[model samples]
Target chain A: MHGDQVTDKNLCLALINQLKWDAVCLTSKILECDDDRLRQDYINILNRTFAEQKQAFDFAKQHGWYQPMLAEQTMIGQVQSDTQKMVNEIQQSMMTMHQQAQYQAMPQQQNLNMGQGMGAFQHYAMPAMGHQQQIYGGSPQQYYR
Target chain B: MPHAKGKITARELLDLQSHLMLESNLVGQFNHFARECTDPQLRQMCESFARSRMDSFQRLAQHTNISPIQ
Candidate 1:
């Protein structure tokens, strides 16, 4: 059968369902058997059933109904590696941008430290304001100076 | 002459046989799914399931002294 014709998930499930029933029947038979030699015979039957199931799977894999597990794992590993690389790149870019921002702000911080009276005056010293406050504390007429 | 006693009890044998069958079925199902699934993630899931089933089967077989036919 063509690959496209056998790709149906339901069909595969149905096939597996049938196999499950067969396995259950074999299990029952194996459990009921008392003779050791006969038990081994039942075990053989079970193994044969399993082998047949495996063969069905092999056929499905050959027809491309499913992908090989190793190949799929390799694909997953590749995707994980790619995603990790992308995350690393993003982290690197973010770190670079942070560093650049810090570098650009350094000059401005130094400029502000040079007694530039701008924005909030927490760090800036108002020398003239200090003089006027001292004079006002002493006398109103001395406040003019 | 007296017959030699079996290494394991009948109940133990039944349990072992039942589990073996169950695990074998699971392994077969997962291996089938691993091979049949088109999606990479799904295929991986099936493959791991198959491996785990086989592992469980091996462990049980070892404890029960029942050699599984590979």
Candidate 2:
């Protein structure tokens, strides 16, 4: 490639990098959004951006302008194992919390069952309301109803 | 279904504005690159990207109006 063409290719790569960054920022925004419609719109735009990014990447690669390095098998394995370990730790913590909540609610549930009968207690009891609030950052009513 | 029929929250408005800015910038960059590139294939790719970004920009811009929540 000529010097000017090389410069153009480098600029194209830079633009592609910008698109990748934009996609990341858009994804974060989507996660933060509360409105379903707005979130869907953002998701649609994100999908388009991803498709265009892929096209730009392929074009650069086809023209011998950009070549990404491949990760080694060992490095890939290490990342996979690390991710699995983190997931396991999160699961274990969640199970412990769930068990503790259930244990704390057992006495209250039993009292309600005995006083109001099993059917009424089942209808009115919200043993995990507090735990749900803690996790969801909202009132029990907002979640239950 | 109708578009933006529900009331737009402040957060959603901010997100839309941010996306509009990004899309506009992308459209400009892609159009510029398309014009500057000497290779036909690269030029076509850049033009295509510019068009897509422009479409996104228009779609996002349409949501800027505030409406009553249904």
Candidate 3:
């Protein structure tokens, strides 16, 4: 495509960075900018430039041009993290179920004695048949640890 | 037309970069003095020239992808 016809996200961000850099340099060159009015005037131009970009973004929402490269990358990363978390939960649940099956296959009397292992099953909702959580702090204080 | 007869030597190529560095130095000197200058108009004018030179130097550095002389 011709350069004029190609509206790329990199080109857009590069243009914005250049414009913002120039605006900052111009503002720095101003001498009496300490005056509130002058400062506000200069700031307004900078703000308007970003505001223009925002309007462009909104207009291009249908074309997906409005989705910033940073935002897109972040969303992809979040999805990966969520998928990993789901996979981990699945694995943990499977392990727990397997251990219960193994225990159930053992002498039924041992399952009755399972209540003594407070460090283990209390973490899960089933609580391994009966000791209370108040003994281990139910507040999820050890939740992260 | 501008005259160009001989091929420029590698040394000359290096010298050209050196000259650009000197030009950048001149810009810094002018800026240093401009900051100390008491006359508002002259100081502003001098500083603006320095700024333009710095911009030029930065453009050249960016174009060549080389460090300007320290």
Candidate 4:
């Protein structure tokens, strides 16, 4: 295929590699277990898992999903770039979500500021001798005294 | 390299990679199993299993005309 053309098959294969790695890790952990009973139990589970995996592989083969590569290194490079693009898109979406959350929080912040303003008026403006005296119909100096 | 039956579909190519990847992983697991086993006979069995997996990996890689597992 062309260098820019990253087919679905390419992506699927790359992801399958991840599953292969998981199987490898599980097998290693199973082998490393010290208890004989536990190891045997793991082996039993692994056997069943392998059987399932084999079925899937067989299905792929039967459906013409497995084919040998003839000659094309461009596919590999295309897959790599496709993966990179996917990563970038994910990062961009995360950033957009973060910005959206911040935007959502701004209205609440403004409401908080409004509450604080009311608190300032109550504590400072109402308690001022000049203002209190004016309201009470007395001299500001007398009210201070 | 074994000649493919027809114009290989993208899906088939991907599946082939999956097969090779799994075989490579199975080899690694077998090697690990061999290392962890204390009994000589069990270790030998694990070692042989690993070898067989490697052989399978080589065959898969060969179909793709890629270098065998490192």
Note the chain A TM-score of all models in turn.
Answer: 0.34, 0.53, 0.30, 0.38
Return the candidate ranking by TM-score, descending.
2, 1, 4, 3
lDDT of each: 0.63, 0.78, 0.51, 0.57
Per prediction, the TM-score for chain B is 0.78, 0.81, 0.64, 0.82
Local accuracy of candidate 1 as per-residue lDDT tens digits, A80-135: 99999999999999999999999998987786455443424423444445434443
Which regions in candidate 2 have their CA more than 4 angstroms from the true location? A1-6, A73-145, B1-6, B66-70
Worst 10 residues of 4 chain A by lDDT: A7-16
Which tens-of-lDDT digit does each residue in B17-41 have in candidate 2? 8888888898898898888878787
Ranking by lDDT: 2, 1, 4, 3
Off by over 4 Å in 3: A1-145, B1-12, B67-70
Mind giving the per-residue lDDT tens digits that candidate 3 earns over A1-145? 4576423443334333444454454345233333343344335544544554354344345446455545578899999999999999999999999999988877755654574456565456355423444555464445436
True contacts kept of each: 0.00, 0.32, 0.00, 0.00
**Per-residue accuracy of model 1 over B1-70 as CA lDDT, tens digit each:** 1113565557656756776677777788778877776757546646764775676567556645456547
Say which docking band candidate 2 falls in: acceptable
Candidate number with greatest TM-score: 2
Clash pairs for candidate 4: A65-B12, A67-B12
Lowest lDDT 10-residue stretch of candidate 2 chain A: A115-124
CAPRI accuracy category, model 3: incorrect
Candidate 2, residues A22-87, lDDT tens digits: the string is 899889989988777668777998998898889888878887888989999999999999999999
- Residue-wise C-alpha lDDT for candidate 4, range A2-99, written one tens digit per residue: 68764433333433343355456447746555444434544554564465345434434554666656756898889889999999999999999999
Worst 10 residues of 2 chain B by lDDT: B61-70
